[model samples]
Target: MKKEDEAKSRRSFLKKAGLGGLSLASFTGASAHIGDQIAYASQNVNRNSSPSDLKITDLRIAEIGGDVVFRTPIVRIYTNQGIVGHGDVRDGAAKEYALFLKSRLLGENPCNVERLFGIIKQFGHHGRQGGGVSGVEMALWDLAGKAYNVPVYQMLGGKYRDKVRVYCDTTVSKDPVEYANRMQARVDQGYTALKMDIGINLIKDIPGALINGHEADYNPYQHQSTKYNMTKHPFTRIQITEKGVDKLMEYLDVMRSKIGYDIPMGTDHWGHIGVNEAIKLARASERYNLAYMEDVIPWQYTDQWREITESSTTPTQTGEDIYRLEGGFEELIKTRAVDIVHPDPNTAGGILETKRIGDFASKHGIGFMHHHAAGPVSFLGCVHSAAATENFMWLEHHAVDKKDWENLVTGFDGPIVKDGYVTVPEKPGIGVELNEEVVKKYLVKGEKLFAPTPEWDKIRAWDRLWS
Candidate 1:
């Protein structure tokens, strides 16, 4: 054909294909590519998914309290594409905390996780209050991963391990021998790491174990009032006497003898004692080579954490209640105040933020350990984070003895907790679906299962933190 005829045909095709406004300059140097562009436009298109549009359609919750003490609220985020993501509010947190986020998430793309998180993060606070936003963040990641056909860990820059190391909390006993036996049982069950509650209450009945008991009638083993729960570490005015330290030492000796030094054993629930006593107790237990003395003082006392970490041979860990990395864990990690950062994903800003926390701690030469007590939904979230984090030591499995714990969810290739490690799921999203039958069997009284939440569909206030 003549050059003029070819040019006329190209112009005719461009106009017919809805590219009529293309300037000659736009394709002036690409005349040779006109045939290729026309060929591309000839292909059939699946308009329904041509651009892969996905949107959050609804959010619901199921509050289930099994044989455990905690009533866990599991949140499900449903998308228009029929893919649903699961997340769990921190145990003991209200379902409304997560439902309240429906107004902020409706019609948003779950793939824009960081953008959505920024919009909703202000609603979260430290501890259980963080559960709502964190849970929603977790669900968003799950949805995003499913939409992209990748595991949650893969969404967090791939994973470091196929199986996550889990540490189970051993049942505590007042009798030292029984306590040792119980720890051995955990070891027998395939747990290589263990944690025990070593507190003054264990030896409080022993004469001269604790000093200054007359003032507050403090009881550490059982919950009393806000007086014991809310008091800062320094203001507790409670001290473990030399005899008390010896008693704790005896318990540790029994545990060490039973579990052996090869296994990493941690201690927690040391009561509301001040820093000095915490230091003393930590020093006293150094011989046992505990994994770390957790929450030696409160997590908020950065200086005190540094003091205990510097003064004792045992590594110190905190941050289970810390909400976000920037304001809550940055100072602690930057200052090296704690030897290990123990974040509960349910409270530490969900999966990605918790991974960020682990990455930050890794930079400071600190170890990362996860603290978890909820059901398998959040537990799997931690599993993915632990699999991705290089500095992760172990994840706490709070439901070691709960027979029905593994039944709450399905989709695992094998046992949820085998021996001691949890195999990270290769499936998309969180990799498990809630067992509705089992969940309903354990639902908290008066709580509905995935009930409609219309009240949270509209915003009612000015939520912007900045003017």
Candidate 2:
């Protein structure tokens, strides 16, 4: 074709594809490279740069004031290409836990998620010890999603639901009627699922409700005694008497009658009681058709969990404090020890691992519920994972009463929680940015917001645990 004809063809193509604004002056000098430049520009339109070249540049921390129970720390992973990702360290965990991983992540491509996760996975442990590595893992997924111009759930494969069902963890009141009234208020606010604390602590003052307390001077609610918090389930030797059981039953009966059977109800915080007592409480509360009895005993006691699962009509659940899927939750799911596997993503090795736990559970006919108590960063991580995983039953919304909880982050198209469900965000990454103005208001006293973490930028020792 003639040179004028070639120019005319190019113009027609650009205009047809809505690239008419792109000047053809640059192509005049180098006709051979015109097609290449156009293709590159098309590829780079939505992205800052080539996704493969994006590198982790820095990691920073911010501690925001949480509810009375905790001060939550948020993590931000910065990349060379200007895409930043957000994550939340487990509530009450140190910022140093996540900062220490900065050395491991610096100059590495965030898109190689599994490779980066494998390199840092050794640093994580069960419970709060896993906060640092898990936080870093979450930031990686967010960065990867943004780099590719897709939502995190799409990067995980695809979504199973657009809105993840959320259950509020309602505070328990000592008075049964008051507790029922409080739960009724949550239902009035459009929550379809709820969980409340059910334990000996509520009736500890009543005569004949508890026995063997004088031996150790154990206080159920107060953790002043080392014997109460440190002792394991079987070793505690704590028992609830028939009168105590009756009081708990009465509380459940009142709650059930108030909420009715249409909404599912779950319970937790059993005050570190033992397997036998867990069974007794489970059997007594079975008539109400509770959603699931959570952490009745510690998650490590798989056999005890099996006993509770087989003996009671109530559903048994555990694993919020557990870590990793292969070793942590595999036994529980494979053995059918629990009806539901509840993983708090901040403690469960972040989003991908949590989804793996849920996928594994689905194979065994078990349910999945994510336990969440941090700020919006980790909550959205759970939202993305819940959207990707098939077995998800619900994600915990612990801040339902905290009117300002959703304000900590921006970029949400609508209300954070609508009618007891969080819409799975479609924007890149976790689909939100830190609302710096709101976050500044909630910074913990004496703590800085996204402060420099230079001290953790170097590694002094080899980290290999095996030859």
Candidate 3:
């Protein structure tokens, strides 16, 4: 009588619950019961948020000091559904770039990431100007991932690797051995690839090593506003003498001797040397077997880049400052101008666009590399992007020397880069939250951490682009 009653109740519940097609007779005492069926049916369901009904309510920012990771501003996109997404404006870019976009994003569904990206992408440009669009794009991906309960890379069409390899972007030193020692420390810390700046400044004071370089007075990294900083490579007429080439060789020789040639070593900060001079240095670099000579000339110089690449055995690379595909990296990849293309996701169009850039480069027989010099918020986004890129070589880690770098974000298991790689995050969204305590300590002078910005709440323009 008791078994009959239980069986009848199970059939009744299944009929009403719309699972009547399943059978009670197929069940055993330990499994296949109606209760078990109910539990299994709901295993994939999440009551987190109504993702489709989700809407953006606000956008806020927290500006951190340069030492915390290139002084990049972090943005938070709030939604009516009680979830928030985090992102980082490109290094050195003003916070206004992202704040200004708030008016345009208000009341929109952040889950429609690509669509919203297209809506505001017009306001973005090359270099740091693209920070606003790129940062917001990252936030949207985060929000969408949370709503869908999937990893950001999973939302970006899945991943190609379980972990993303990182290369140490070693701190610059005028002394080659000092720089090499810092990089050796990274190798000891388990880095498999390395990069260092070996610029004209190293040989600047050496008489007869350079010609027409007297006016080149400022360090491009420290002083971008100066005349020398604004001038292009070709315009500077900064020619390196055969002696200068030898002087550069000495640095490479010491580096190779100290760190060895087993791991890939790339070079950057060539300073504004022209196409011919870059080609000369490229030829000189052939003997050291450099992994690449980064930004030998500016990215816009496609013709000049091709000239340099074709003229030397040293691999050439550029495009860390490019924003989008069509007008940004298309010409370089199509023309086979560089052996590899690198793009910082924060400045290069965020996650998906960078993925597209890599896919496009791979189609052209070019390898893809990641460039990152910002805080961990954007660094994690770059990790997801790199994991999704099939041809990815190495993701640049500018904070390898910053001991507290990983502490800037909370809820992560271990150091971001362990044994020279960042494990692809399995958690939803970009995978971690900003550690508020650490962030407050490093906030830019007047900026609060993720402060509310009601001042940018109103859209002021008739923003339609065309008829």
Candidate 4:
């Protein structure tokens, strides 16, 4: 066949195989000679992804604030084919986690996702520390998906569901009636399931509610950094009196009166109380039929989690702070510590890893729920992973009230969440692009948008796990 005819046939075959029109721009940028063959940018698509030739040219990150979580570190991985993929560090996590891997990833093909993830997985640890390696993994999947012109979910063995059911986590409220009304409002707004903070503060002002009290000067609302908040559940020795359980039940009571048992509700932020208090709260919440009692104690306390799950009728959950499946989830799932395994995709090693966790959990008859409270990038990455996860119950939608949150990324039609679920996107990569103008306005203080990081481009330490 003639050269033109041959090119046409190849394009036709690729299109038929669901891998055409990648439109990746090559012969420009950093791509000199990638793989065995050469490809070029086309007029119709303009940008293209040459799968075999795709190389990670650069990785840049920006910390975005306002409307989203406190501050979510977003990463953009640029490839040789002019295809840029987006990922996000867990909200409140340092961008350094992802940027620190730049030297290891530079010049490697983005399509070698599993191989590359193994290289960087060593850098990830549990909690916010895992955000960096997880973010890099997200961007790599996005890059690989784009390179093949398929959605991220499709790359993850396709999706099991068309849309993912979302559970919105509402703000904390002190007043019993007011908190109930807030939860009701979410139900009215089409959220089928809801999660709210049922913490000590709700009953703190009530007399005889708490014992071994929080310090007066410390504001428990912005209490994350406080010495009081820093103490682990068991060490705090904090106790919630019967009155405290009564006051908390009042919140659940009032909530049930407003929204009733029809709406699936989950309670979280049950405060710094220990095993006995956690059991009390869980037992008190049983009559209300809460979806689960989340983070009853630190996830490291597998025995505590098993205790809570066994003691109460209500479901038990944890693992948002856990990293890879091998990190803590293996023990949690195998031992059946919690009824539901909650993982934030950005904090749990991104899409594939999170999906793997869910898949593993499903075999043992445990359900996985995504704990998402980040920007759209991380949220959508969770959405993709959740869609692919067969037994995932419901994914958390923390920004239900943030009107501008969905505007941060373009690619989805209408609201990202509608009627308590997010439609699985069919677009390539993570399926969204940052609305740069809107994103620039939300830049965290002193943080630039996708800034250069030549300093991080150097390998600082020997990363070998074995000599």
Of the candidates shown, which would achieve the greatest TM-score relative to the real structure? 2
Candidate 3 per-residue lDDT, tens place, 1-467, comes to 37787677666655655754555554545334666657755566787889989999999999987556678889999999899999999988988999999999999999999999888888888999989899999999999999999999999788899999999877678787897788788899899999988878889899889887744454433444547767877877789999989999888998999999998999999888898899899998899999999997889989989999999999999988999987999999999999999998888888999999999999999989998888898999999998888899999888876777788998789878899999999988999988899889889888887878999999988899787
Lowest lDDT block of 10, candidate 1: 43-52
**How does each model score on TM-score?**
0.87, 0.92, 0.91, 0.88
Candidate models: Cα lDDT each? 0.86, 0.87, 0.87, 0.84
Give me the displacement of residue 148 in model 2, in angstroms.
Answer: 0.9
User: lDDT tens digits, residues 1-467, model 1?
Assistant: 57897677666656756764655454554556576665765566333221158888999998888595378899999888788889989999988888888998999898889999999888888999999998999888888877777789998889999999999886779999999999999888888998999887788677788785423355542454556557777876878778778888999998888778999989999888888888898888888888899987889899888989999889999989999998999999999999999999999889999999999999989999999999898899899989999888899999887888888999888899998988999988888888899899998888888988887889888897787
What candidate 3 gets wrong by more than 4 Å, as runs, is 1-4, 7-44, 215-226
Q: In model 1, what lDDT does residue 243 have?
A: 79
True-vs-predicted CA distance for residue 107, candidate 2, Å: 1.0
Which stretches of model 1 miss by more than 4 angstroms? 1-51, 214-226
- Select the stronger candidate by TM-score from 3 and 4: 3
- lDDT winner: 3
> Cα deviation of 38 in candidate 1 (Å)?
18
What is candidate 4's TM-score against the reference? 0.88
Q: Mind giving the per-residue lDDT tens digits that candidate 4 earns over 310-363?
A: 998999989899999996799999999999999988889989999999999999
